[model samples]
Target: MKKRGIGIAVGTHPAGLKGGGDPSQAQIRLKPDGTFDLLNGAVDIGQGCKTILRQLAADELDVPLENITHQNIDTDTGPMCTGTFASRVTFMDGNAVLAAAADLKKKIRDWAAEYFECSPADVEVANNKVFVKGVPEKSLSMAEVGAMVNWGGKFLVGTGAYTPGPGQQFDPETGKMTAIASLAFGCCVAEVEVDTETGVVDVLKLVQVFEVGKAMNRLLCKGQNNGGAMMGIGFGLTENVCPYYPTMDFAVQDLTDYVITTAADMPPVMVEDIVEVPHPNGPRGAKGYSEMTASLAGPAILNAIHNAIGVWITDYPATPERILKALEAAHA
Candidate 1:
């Protein structure tokens, strides 16, 4: 006999390092060809940090996205970044990029003002052109400005760094600090089928929703959501490192002994829903949401298994042996 059940779980995630002091730095330089080089240390571990930062830079500098080239992180030459984790890259590093772009824009305006013998306040930089405000007749392309600036033995550069304010305040009694800069919320619903005879559980479908502050790129956000859902299912059903623990006699050591969820094991992602509630302090109101999804699916799947078999799985992976033992104990 087989039974089906549904389970749901909700969760929240914090962006940036806990207890504060997390910092990121960035630099921007105008090339002679009118392109801008954005240098930062936010590594892209498949989370699309590079694309997001470039987007932020393009917008902040008031230039076409194609005019911005995001330089890859280089330890020796690049700016400082406190590594990428805790969903902090988009928010923390993004701020640094914005700062650098703002500085660069100001420098360009000042230089353009000097060349036109006008006040810096009267110069406006937009769409790859610098022009005197309300005096459209006097304007110069950014490419021309860059060429002239470089040829005049001068450099046009901007630099910026960001830290989440000062150190967070901690509770004296509990030793807990106010650590989070932004919060992302998520909820997941899982449907599963359980086989009574073999103690096998199969996930049929998943519906996930998340409040990600802002979707800088909707397709990228959706990809992160779906990928995280798959990871959650794997943690609940298939991936395990220590098959035999506490005794430590026969631990699964290699790939052949270990089990993981594959494409064949993936369930349909029925709904990929995202809520865009802008954050006041985020980079264009964007927050970190990738890590939150990885956690939601496991508990939801466990709950669904309990609903199907009337037994709770206290451990991860919920291997067949454990499920059968739970069932037998319940029956007994």
Candidate 2:
């Protein structure tokens, strides 16, 4: 099936042209030299969106990813894009890249047909060639085809633009909140053991499952999940940034006192499973998967702790004192 249309937006904040003006854009040019230039506004913050998007484009255009050159994002040269947040860059900018590459592919096919004196259907883009199908010997390199088309002084350039949906406001009086767009659901089950005396929490295992419209890169997906799980541990036990003396001037200082999840604290992370319910607005049906992990981590760990020691503590961090207090209350 011919994959058409842009993917949906997946994040707390929807990116759209009208809303917040944070839509992402890109300019792509297929050169006659069998190479391409991609000008993207999205930044790569170790999430692997850069490599994944490039792979998607190469697969669609039948070009090797190595042949593509990525240009650094410069406000002057790149399109206006929002900063990387809420994990929206891959979905929004990825669509833009796909759209631009599709346009270039169509143009190349049309030009190739004219040059070969055959129907456009007779031409196929494979291994950097615009040639008649089944006749590899009579094929033209992408560079040659591009040169032929650009001989008329027209460059093969295409642009893609993507905007997310609007925001939904909460009802202050009703204490209700409505989603501006679609919601991605997820669940995680964790097994933990807490030392009632020391108040130290140890995660024995984590089983997480999420519905991320699609999985662009399984490796990247796992990374995001594991990272979020680690962060969630911190939120539950180590991230204790309390105000000092009820005054704003001082706060808990240093990582030594403010603990977070370390390698020793994390157990084997078992990815239970992931279901891909393609989003209407996502690129290839992918949705956000970072923050949700943290959301599930807190509740899952807390519940497990409660199950382990017949006590329920409302406060966070569950310091030794808090656990002991809860234990005393439970016995009393």
Query: Candidate 1: where are CA atoms >4 Å away?
Result: 174-176, 247-249
Error of 2 at 145 (Å): 2.8
The positional error of residue 138 in candidate 1, measured at the CA in angstroms, is: 1.6
Worst 10 residues of 1 by lDDT: 241-250
TM-score to native of every candidate shown: 0.96, 0.81
Residue-wise lDDT of candidate 1 within 42-91, one digit each (tens)?
Answer: 88989998889999999988888888888875856899998889999988
Model 1 gets an lDDT of 0.88
Q: Which regions of candidate 2 fall more than 4 Å away from where they truly are?
A: 1-22, 117-123, 132-138, 146-152, 166-182, 243-250, 328-332
lDDT of every predicted structure (CA atoms) = 0.88, 0.70
lDDT of 2 at 315: 68
Q: Using TM-score, give the best candidate's number.
A: 1
Residue 248 C-alpha lDDT in model 2: 45
Q: Backbone collision count in every prediction?
A: 0, 10
